[model samples]
Target: HEPVPTEWTRTTCPYCGVGCKLEVGVAGDRIVATRPVIDAPSNKGHLCVKGRYAHGYVDAADRITVPKVRHDGRWRSTDWAEAITLAADGLRRVAAEHGPDAIGVLGSSRATNEENYLTQKFARVVIGTNNVDCCARVCHTPSAAALKHMLGTGVATNSFDDIEQAKTLLVVGANPLENHPVVGARIRQQAQRGAHLIVIDPRRTGLARIADVHLAPRPGTNVPLLNSLAHVLFAEDLVDRDFLAARVEGVEGLAAFMAPWTPERATQLSGVPADAIRRAARLYALERPAMALHGLGLTEHLQGTQGVMALIDLALLTGNLGRAGSGINPLRGQNNVQGAAVMGCDPGTLTGSVRLVDACQRFEAAWGVALPHKPGLNAVTMIDAAHAGKLKALYVIGYDIFASLANADVTAMALSKLDLVIVQDMFLNETANSFGHVFLPVVSSFEKDGTFMNSERRIQRVRRAVAPRGDSLSDAEVLCRLAGELGFGDQFRHTCAEAVWDEIRAVWPAVAGISYGRSSRHGLQWPCVDEYDPGTAVLHARRFANADKAKLEQVDYRPTTECTSEQYPFLLTTGRTLHHFNVGTMTGRTRQQLLRPTDTLDMHPYDAGQLDLRDDMPVRVESRHGEVVLPLRVSDAVAPGQLFATFHDPARMLNRLTGPVRDTVTSAPEYKVVAVRVRLA
Candidate 1:
């Protein structure tokens, strides 16, 4: 017999938001090799550990190759037609008995923009409900809310390519080295080129080891630290007076609010020295063309949005906006989380952040359906509503809510209470195991054709490298078929991914000109209105999206809700690692599991010694919500009273120990700080 012929395809990585372009070689329906494209704008021929080796999971033995239906609390194999019919009937029955508002649809950040657009359309046009959302609600909702309110857009103000031109870089609350290795490498390269680096994280991360200044403040104390920096800028006269006078507003309100937060007070509160605060402030203020970037650490708190607003205030005060080398950038966690949000996965806004009424009118003209007028429930609110017996049915796509939500126990109970649950993913995830009535298998990024928007808002193509395994279908195909079953057959006549993108272009003006032809060589950024018009790399060049000037919000410091108590003596924080991602569904199935086989509780030497806990000793961490037992690893990365852990392990169930405290404005649960007690097993 002759060996199968090989073919090559170009696509983007599926792991992080760096969006490294790759050339994949396939043979006989298998992905043989993946290499980084030398001319790719984001990575430039660099591939991280996950991106290089995580493709093995595409052919894993445990993948779901057929659809399944739950009967008598057990999943049984079924065909696509049967599964779609069962799911459609279940949803219709629930909506008929209850109201249209009783049904909720949960989209996925891991999916593509075309699939997300179809999912939301199906929810609004077919189900006639606005209860739609994605995992961004738990991760970057504060970023979206705060950035839009302050700078008129909820995205990065500048591109990652501008990092090399910056004179100084201020990274706050994010350990990009472990989470986003490609961007981390670029930051290191910029530092080597004489760019001053300042890291603001509680942990002694890789970049912090070589930083010119590392402000290791106490957890959940970002607002005061930022305010103190502003105070120093005002007192030392380091602020850009001309920029403020020309391109800013509400300066008087900011001055009055920041007048009382002195460096000394901030030092006492945040455990960062007053001298260090002053030096950081001076460097950040005096350094022209400085860039600021942050991650979930700055946005997963009770005062998350306020922290983002304060950071934006710093950038505005220092004249960092409307330039090539200076702006505020939020490092998105997932590869397509930004794209999913921009595709109108949120219930409050439509595509391109348009008003609900205006978006409904425009989409009605195009889609020819009556859309919902009011805003619907978010991810957290939908779960709460399900627990209260208000929400009846839920349609989840490529998300495991049980392991991802803050309170896993409560999320599981809510899943068990729902009347109907339809899940679509490559595997039977934790949430599906509890409540999924119909399960549809979907293909991986390597086996699909679509586009994903990176953190820089660059829309990149994801071409199909190989055929999908067995009877697995693409998310768009499944969604279209389900729509046909739900009486919206005429509206959803898309035959391929390109047709869906055509509809997206008709609705979203940001990427109207970005077609498959234009994106063949390299991905294009948003705001590309025409084919001849080059995409925008930097935003706010002349004026902000709202007004000519940016707004400086007046914000104050607020303590975290779960403070240390006599019973719960330590502050527990959750995060990700380099080898594993959220919930560890894909990476766990690959050889990446051997690198870090089990989750561990990280504590400082002082805390471990006081508790008589030794290295590699199994210990139980208990919180008000729940408890989990894992081996302890003593390290100096965390503070004396602080403990850290990751949620990559499903059996360990780290989120079970986290509570339901959330941000006041965005409902983003505070996964950074939790009150817990430790005991040796």
Candidate 2:
């Protein structure tokens, strides 16, 4: 057994979106143990299994801490200088020969805000391309797009603290218990305090266990169910006239638009009981103050954006926004997803609500250089373009684009077609395998000093716990060195992340209020002006950012083109398991974590019973695109005709079986509901 530590370092948990502040115990140079900070708002004196015991991954045996280069179809250990020159030369040569449009950059949501900002900036300014995106593109791009369309911003309007005061909590398509345990615990606490909990999902999830009303509707049926709830609320005269008139706009069109969605019609389409729908509507409407929390499950379908609009309609119909304990909240999957989006990870975006073209014009006037106006392809489309011989080089930072993208085989083939691929990551990831030219070893979160913005938009510090392991360097350091080598050192020179942040604040208006100094204490939330000016806890409180006003869109129900059939009799949904994070590169390094890993499929008892299978039975699950054989876990939490799988294990190859259908608005793949078939192996 390990000996007790003498001192503990106060830091944040490296897992989950909860962003719990952790106090890690260190003995000499190694981490011994970790505990929760007693005063952190996200987690007060509590820690999860992963957060408490997963520190070993930092000093794991299999970590590739040194820089390596792939030359002549083989990898060779290389020094920092050779690696940097090779990466810069390869990327520049590709851009010089094949036009800037031929290249794309993939940012990371798990990275610090400063790192995300610089990565996107490198793609846009240095590489002279608008082909920049992040992991949020796959998980919550629809949420950001839909929220911006309706609420005038791309972030959650409510904080986790609001749960304590909410009278009703409506969770749609999010299993916080397993995915976001701290948030789930808070919801449970609220449930124990008599706050009505309503869950809308295709499966009976962990959250469903504590929900007062769990509507296990069929997959892709969110639009109908949400619309019907709005119908019931409006028909019953539960609409708050005062709240609607004072706080919301376009109240007239909302009533006429939702008239077609009756409870009976919704029941016929969605499989939830008409009475249950009515009861849920009544409970949500009658409850004085309620909040709506959604996750990827709502935004990873064919009609994802439309479903988000329907949920907004329900919130507006019941006057559940723009006040204490009431707002539209999306529980982001990644740690810094909101910050990444806000800091301009999207190709057509800029900090402070500026579009690429418009912001470039403004930035050109400031920096004395014209920025590129042509918008580039998104992550998924970029791969397709590459496969079709339209795109050439790709510079990926922090993200493992291969496994994260839907249809791994298709993406891998696309990568193979690229003339040059530059992967800058802490490990030799699945995406890094496609690097034809160079690979740069970058510092992991533990070896770096930076700032990460939590889901609440709170900008917090990530102090360097240790020196750069092996020959690895921070992403910022690598980018700065590359910029210097390319004769752009004058522009990229910075002592630390703060100096880079100051440049961003000077140019980007949305980030104008935030500063490193202000963020030092208790982590100030964004839209923060000064030390005295308290940061905004909730957004769009008085009026939307749009100069005119909010106009509620008239949304109608439309089913996904792909549906369950005789050959593909089940709907496949993908998500994170309690034991692991996305792609399982970081968390997979731990021996204990691997022992309790998410290398299996979770299915309902009825589905397994019908297939003549028992718990832990090996089964081959297949879809049109691909298939995998995994150990079955028959759980009552999920419903029959639906299967849940996790992409945490590379061995599982779950993404191989899911494909191609993407949101037209965001280019995010519909990973939540895909038609598939399962059989005993």
Taking the tens digit of each residue's C-alpha lDDT, what string does model 1 give over 348-401? 888787768767888888899889888999999999999999999999999898
Q: Looking at model 1, report the run of 10 residues with the lowest lDDT sum.
A: 1-10
What lDDT does the true structure give each of the candidates? 0.90, 0.80
- Model 2: how far is 276 from its true place, Å? 1.2
Question: Which residue pairs show collisions in model 2?
Answer: 204-637
Worst 10 residues of 2 by lDDT: 544-553
What TM-score fits each model?
Answer: 0.98, 0.97
How far out, in Å, is residue 466 in model 1?
A: 0.7
Query: Which stretches in model 2 have alpha-carbon errors above 4 Å?
Result: 434-436
What C-alpha lDDT, on a 0 to 100 scale, does residue 645 get in candidate 1? 92
Residue-wise lDDT of candidate 2 within 1-681, one digit each (tens)?
A: 676877666666667767777777767657777788787877777877778787776776766677788878898888888888887887788888888888898887767778887777777778788888888888888887888888877778878888898999999999888788888889999999899999998877777877899998888888888988888887899898887776677777778878888989998988899999998999888986899899888998877787788888788778787777888888887777777777777888876547776677887675555678877787878888899998898888878888888988888888989988888877778888754467787776766766777777677776666667788788888888887776677667788988878877787655577777766656776777655667888777777766234666678777787788899998888888787888887778775465666577878888787888998888898888888888999887667788888888876778998878887678888898878998898
- What residue pairs clash in candidate 1, if any at all? none
